[model samples]
Target chain A: GAGVSQSPSNKVTEKGKDVELRCDPISGHTALYWYRQRLGQGLEFLIYFQGNSAPDKSGLPSDRFSAERTGESVSTLTIQRTQQEDSAVYLCASSLGQGLSYEQYFGPGTRLTVT
Target chain B: AQSVTQLDSQVPVFEEAPVELRCNYSSSVSVYLFWYVQYPNQGLQLLLKYLSGSTLVKGINGFEAEFNKSQTSFHLRKPSVHISDTAEYFCAVISVSGGYQKVTFGIGTKLQVIP
Candidate 1:
């Protein structure tokens, strides 16, 4: 892909249900990131993946939030038993990851609405 | 730990008018700074970054940012803005070591360029 691609531009799911969001990073990019944005609010860091290394899951809000990446190409974010507060735009980004100056490229984002 | 703060929630400017969006951050060590813009229903796009060297950094869309280490700020500025500039601007900071350190984002400031 020419850019980072995300699945399901908009998702409307019932509360307590589970949803999985996918992110396909730019080709050969070694770093992938996930972020959450509430309505009219700041972005909250979720997780980050660097190649085949262990992902940094420090920002996952709870145990219900988890993510995985394979071969540093595609990643998936799963929110189990979603809550009302989980409704937000989930954004994925990728970067070269070699230097401190690598600027991330972002996807269109998946807007999730919990009802 | 790292965190970012965007003081203003909204800013309105007339077309061709100058504008500034303020951002601040806190980190224990030297960090890289960045500014990203999110247009309506789109993903975030990197506006600029200050990894090292000069404090001033130029970016696409006629946007620029000044990295102030003393003030712990990275403020985005434009000499003139267009109606198309209406969007949400976010400031971010990450560790200089890189590698999956989740970038912390500010709350974001909505730039409204009015005609």
Candidate 2:
């Protein structure tokens, strides 16, 4: 893809249900990132992946939230037991390199709603 | 550890008027600053970034920002805003190490340009 792409533009589920979000980053991008934006709130960092290196999960809110990336191409974020607080727009971004100065390209984001 | 603060939650201005969105950041180490804009039902797009060199950085749509090291602030400004410039603006900072590259975002400021 020419840019970062996210799946399932919107998802509605009951509380405590599990959900999965997918992200396909731009081709040749070595760094991928996940973020969450609650309604009228700032974006919260979730996780980051740099090529085959170990992913940094320090940003994950809890054990219920986990993410995985395969060979720097595609990634998936899973929420085991979703809560109302989990309702937000899940955003995915990819960068050409691993430096903080590198520019990031973002996806359209997936809106998740927990009723 | 880093944090960004956007003082104003919303700013309303008339078309052809100038506008400024204030952003402040706190970090123990050197970091890069960025500004992103999000339209309705869309993802974030990088407006500009300040890495090094001159303190003044110009970006798309005639937007520019200045990095003030003494004040720890990077405020975005536009000479004249158009109706199409209405959007949510976010300020972000990435750590110098870039290992995790955690981007801490501000609560965003909604810019409304009325004709």
Candidate 3:
């Protein structure tokens, strides 16, 4: 079976521009998550989506960061007015359901460089 | 709220030698612990997890972790390591309180297996 996958493995954009990163979770996964990983740092939780429930946006660092998921499939993370600090690896993960017990499958990640 | 701490930033061990990576977490409520490994240029993968029963959890690639509730720790260990074991390891925890499940990750520990 195909594992979770992210598109545009590498993206370079202007600091003021907006960028959208896409993720395709494994088949039948009902929960998805987004995270940011800066060089030499840990994974920073960004947002989570479970089935049709309202997405968990509490981890969003700022109003400029937002994510959307349709049903239980694809998810897109959009960053508005990106800053140099936004440069990092954007990782996407998914699991069988919405709980801590389920194992998360991660995507290769999209490296965004805000120039 | 939950937080994870990885005591060592790096662990260097000779091939075929034992290795240990310490991790500690704090949370007001019950939690689930997990260990993830990330090889260079690849996505993160689950190494092991401790959700319920069985304090000693085994994972892929001859990896294992022991969950110590009293010490609030879940340290990863391997009896012997191979050069291919060189990678970054991250410890994570999710608080299972209220309706939301928020996961926190520790700053990864880089494992350098010297041959």
Candidate 4:
């Protein structure tokens, strides 16, 4: 029983470059979530996916930020033409969908730096 | 609109001493409350949650929080905190609307446990 896992652990890109952060959640978890944490702030909800339902992308700051989860296994969060403000830790979490199981398992986030 | 507020941005306490971190939220409808801990360079981990039942909810790492509906506050408490307790704590609220779950988080409270 492994917990959620994120790739790269760190990402460094230029101001105008694009970056993609990947997340691999635990098996059989039907709900996935993405969050961002700035340097000295709390976690900010970015998006959430529950099974085949349409994702809740309202938390996304702008249209430039987009995420996609393939079939409930992996998710990728992409930032286009990243800006300095886009630098933050992107975290992924998984939970048992349906019912009232709100307990989520988190992964070590990917630290993104836009220089 | 729902929002979370964490007044104290930082709290310093001696090892083995009791500690308290306050959290408050404003919402007209029902909501699920949660407390999460984030170690340095790690993702957020669930500390406790208050959905229904007992107002005083106990969580991992000797942490507990009392949910006060009248006060609209959920304050986390630990009788004896260790050095390992030094981390960032976040209070979050999730409410469903329009067939989507919306999560709102407060500015994290950094706990510094002194030796």
Candidate 5:
């Protein structure tokens, strides 16, 4: 019954610091995804996890971005040495499966600001 | 690869007036189309999706979209809009022909419903 949820509704950090955004997907969901939304821009795919398979990291802009999901439950997105360009809203979504037909339910997102 | 294009960045329409949000996509293979709405300070919500079968798909809040394979388009429309309908609408596509189904989202359209 619960929807996706994310922690730290807002985060402010230094340019060289690292930040971790957490996401709690809906119960029984087997698919989870992370995206970045910059101001005045669209959602950019970051990574995704489906069950026990290897996560898709193709959309990661750099090596600093990494994510991990523990057995189809909670997921965490970590950004190392954050930059001003990485300042944006980090959103998480989950679905029943990896099927193209399944709909994704999104979380409120964590707004990260680098100063 | 798949990509989505939202022609208009913003659309201002009076309440109870018909409105359309244009969306076009390009993909090397067959794809699934979707529309998502985002309210202020909130995450995206699925408005509708076109997986297969009928070309005309209906969604929540009296919204609908027609999938045109020939023109590579999936435009969202509503007979009448409410002031509460003011939000950002996003068009997305996912290719079904391949290994990993990555969703590509458009820049989005900001719909400002004037009362």
Candidate 6:
């Protein structure tokens, strides 16, 4: 893809249900990131992936939130037993990783609304 | 731990008016600074970055920011803004941990350019 891409641009799920947001980063990119943007707030770091190394999960708000990436390609963010407060836009980004400028290319985020 | 702060929650300005959005961060070690913009219904786009260079960094759409190490701030500004510039702006910092990069974001500032 020419740019980062995300699936199910909009999602409506009931409280307690699980949701998975997908991200397809640019080809050959070695780093991927996941972030959350609440209404009227800034982007919040969730998780990070660098090649095949263990992901940085320090930003996950709780045990309900998890993310995984395979090799240097697609990534998935799964939220278990979603809460109303979980309503926000989930964004994904990719970068060239170390040895280059750390500018991240973002996708059109998935807006999840838990009713 | 690294953290970021955006002083202003919202700022309104008339078209063609100059504007500045304030951002500050706290870090124990040298870090990479960045500014990102998010238009309505879109994902974030990197505006500029300060990674060991001149303090003044220029970005797309006539945006610029000055990285002040003393004050620990990176403020975004535009000589003149257009209605299209109405969007949410975020400040971020990249900190290296165990050979991997960890990004932290501040509470965003909404720039509303009135027509």
For DockQ, candidate 2 versus 3, the one ahead is 3
DockQ of every candidate: 0.78, 0.77, 0.79, 0.74, 0.79, 0.83
Residue clash pairs of candidate 5: none
Regions of candidate 3 where Cα sits further than 4 Å from its true position:
A99-101
- Residues B20-44, model 2: lDDT tens digits: 9999999998888999999887789
Per-residue lDDT over A1-115 for candidate 4, one digit per residue giving the tens place of the 0 to 100 score: 8999999899999999989999999999998999998888788889999888999898899999999999989999999999999999898998887465777889999999999
**Residue A8 lDDT, candidate 6, scale 0-100:** 87
- What pairs collide in candidate 1? none
What ranges in model 4 sit over 4 Å off?
none
Task: Please give, as one word, the docking class of candidate 4.
Answer: medium
Instruction: Give every prediction's interface RMSD.
Output: 1.5, 1.3, 1.1, 1.5, 1.2, 0.9
Fnat of each prediction, in sequence: 0.91, 0.79, 0.76, 0.79, 0.82, 0.82
Clash counts for the predictions, in order: 0, 0, 0, 0, 0, 0
Would you list the rank order by TM-score, best first?
3, 5, 2, 6, 4, 1
The whole-model lDDT of each prediction reads: 0.89, 0.92, 0.92, 0.92, 0.92, 0.92
The superposed Cα distance between candidate 4 and the true structure at residue B34, in angstroms, equals: 1.0
Which pairs clash (backbone N, Cα, C closer than 3 Å) in model 3?
none
True contacts kept of 5: 0.82
After TM-score superposition, the amount by which residue B81's alpha carbon in candidate 5 deviates from its true location, in angstroms, is 1.3
- Pairs in clash, predicted candidate 2: none
**Candidate 6 lDDT over residue span B24-101, tens digit each:** 999988899999888887778889999987999999999999999999999999999999999999899998867899
Residues B8-61, candidate 5: write the lDDT tens digits: 999999999999999999998888899999988778999999998999999999
Can you write out model 1's per-residue Cα lDDT over A26-96, one digit (the tens) per residue?
98899899999889888898998887888888889999999989897889999999999999999999998
Q: How well does candidate 5 score on lDDT at residue B17?
A: 98
Clashing pairs in 6: none
Candidate 4, lDDT over the whole model: 0.92
